[model samples]
Target: MAKLRTTFVCSNCGYSSPKWSGQCPGCREWNTMNEEVEEKTKVSAVSSVKSKTVFSSVSSVTEISTGDELRYNTGIGELDRVLGGGLVKGSVVLLSGDPGIGKSTLLMQACGTFSRDKTVLYVSGEESAKQLKLRAERLNVNSDKLFVMTETDVESICEYIKVNKPEVVMIDSIQTMNNAEIQSSPGSVTQVRECTNLLLRTGKSLDIPVIIVGHVNKDGAIAGPKVMEHIVDAVLYFEGERNYAYRILRAVKNRYGSTNEIGVFEMGDGGLSEVENPSQALLSERNVNVSGNCISCVMEGSRPILAEVQSLVCTSGYGNSRRMSTGFDFNRLSLILAVLEKRFGYRFSGMDTYLNIVGGLKLDEPAADLPVALALVSGFTDKPVPDDVVAIGEIGLSGEVRSVSRISARISEAARLGFTKCIVPRSCLKQIKTKADIEVIGVRNLHETIANVF
Candidate 1:
């Protein structure tokens, strides 16, 4: 043995210190330092010289080969859409979600598809081979080219990969993996960082794509050092309530494709099925002519989706009024209410206000502001917005309806969905040249919109 040493490391940020402290200096998180063992070995001069000799000359960006042939379809259209067409060769992808959020189910389905024409290896550190088989049987995944192995040691997993030469490899989770060279326990910051680097090297060296599953913390962030995300080529998050059947896949970072795209999937008894027409499915259960309800068309990536915005206004029982928003920003709701009171003279201070976005979808774009304001006003007056209308605009502090991007696509989608009327900004009306039969009404401010819409 060369020497046994110990040091304190911050589990949140991977910062090392000679002694433990109450707070991590790097991440400013309290009580996250843990003692980890280390064995120090000095490299000889000859070994150091040989390591320096292994460096390769850098190549110009123009000299690098690039084409569509490098992409591999994972057999799921929704997944392919999120992945910017398909998985890239020699790329590393990290998939993260809440527990039991169908991360494994989605990947298993993809593996079944990839195994049809290429070899795939599924490594599980948390579950036994028999347990994975049970899931595969439940998912009805029967592929001759898919291989499964239960292993926790990263080095041994790499050895198996080297011998088998799998076309693609999937680690069930990076947190459960451990490196013998690192004395920290599995899931520690050190082990996660080192193991991911090793897997990244293996993928690049073998020209194979590797997919790694990750767990999310209570804050809904990936449970690892930030470097783990920086190392991967793409970072995808699975979002949606576990109780709901709908799940949304979003890419936060992508080296091979655009990050704004999102994929929608519906969880079924058999597994996950892609939602081909998300707009139609989202509006399937709308209540016609209901007070406090208004439809809005917002763009998700390049696709336009129509969703219902609902609001409720009632007298406050307590001394202080309460404001609550679900699937909509609470601060933005307050701003809208202030604008309504200042510009339209609507009294919202003495009442409790509630806002919700239907279909379990979050509305983050500014284009939703107009519909939200309309819904608030409709609820306060106990009047319902027109069933045949859809609103698309951004409301500013001056109560002015601002033009939103891609107005043509929004109106076209509304028309396709059988809407006969569209409430949009006056500036956007000038740009619309569509022959769609829908009547597009242009409003300059919230006052005009309230008079015309109501």
Candidate 2:
């Protein structure tokens, strides 16, 4: 019999220690260390003979074959774009998001497409088979090749996979899975880690792709140890506000594809539908010729998306003016405000400023800086920029507009969306080899931009 031992593990980083402490030494996060039980197996003493072992042959990189078809289409164009063409074989993808964020719905919707030709195993630990069937019916996903199982035991699930090898395996979530060998409760650090490792081994050995759903913590990060993310071939995050119908699927890590790609989807009664033209959808309800509203173009992988930047500026009633930003970085906002005050003579210290990116889409690229600044200036002056104008450039500390990458693509997308004018950095004017129908106006600095827009 194995002896049961207890150890403290960090939920954030999966670091184990013999003693409990207020803070985790590995991750330096406080209150994340939790005690977990582990069993230690004893070695036999009658081991005089060596055990036989099988070794895998190593092949040269040039000798390896590359003609095999290794990707499976999930039947979703937007998803395929984010997955770098399609789902790679033997790849373990971790999909995570907030509850009710359509994580399960997205996978269930894909099962309909996957089960068209290949067999799929949909394992659910959170919902019963009947409940899954009800949801599938609502989603209009009816497929004979799709099989559902309400199971939580990791060993049993892997054994079943071995006996009946399904082309695709979808785990509803990894947190609910438990290993009988691990004494810790399900969703615990040890149990989650062991279960994922077991599933990963099975998927790789059988050349089957495994898609595992994951839950997010309060901080909006994937729940369980951070090592879980490192173990998976791809880590995809479904991002959007619950109140909003728009959802953005982003890949933070992809071994076979670019991580910069994102997929847009709109939630409805029939489940999630792909937003083919995200720019048009995002700007569908945008009010024209409105003060504090500006359009910006950003590149998500090879696709360029146009998003609306909105700003609100008003007199501050308190001692200090408040600065709030949604879907954009706060420090970047502060820097832009400082540049406006120092170089452009915009008095924002005495006024409260708010910034938001419409459509629940976050603007992380520096190219959004130009439109954000423009929106802020428009809000402060109570002047509306032209309705058919889009801005694409990065703002420097000296208030100079800096050139951004993919200037041609950005302008082309804006032009396709019916924008008449594009405000770009003067330095990028030379990079625009393909002449777009929209009038391209290049500005050198904040002074020129304000002179042209207003």
Best by TM-score: 2
User: Which residue segments of model 1 deviate by more than 4 Å?
Assistant: 1-54, 66-68, 219-222, 225-227
Candidate 1 collision pairs: none
Tell me model 2's lDDT, rounded to 2 decimals: 0.90
lDDT tens digits by residue: candidate 1, 72-96: 9999998999899999999999998
Error of 2 at 331 (Å): 0.7
lDDT for each residue of candidate 2 in 1-454, tens digit (9 for 90 to 100): 7888899888878888999998889988788778888776732211211132223435688987754888999999989988988999999999988889999999999999999999999999999999999999999889999999999998899999999999999999898998887778887787787788889888987889999998876431223536599889999999998899999999999999999999999999999999999999999999987899999999988899999999999999999999999999999999999999998899999999999999899999999999999999999999998999999999999999999999999999999999999999999999997577999999999889999999
Off by over 4 Å in 2: 25-30, 42-54, 219-225
RMSD of each: 3.1, 3.1
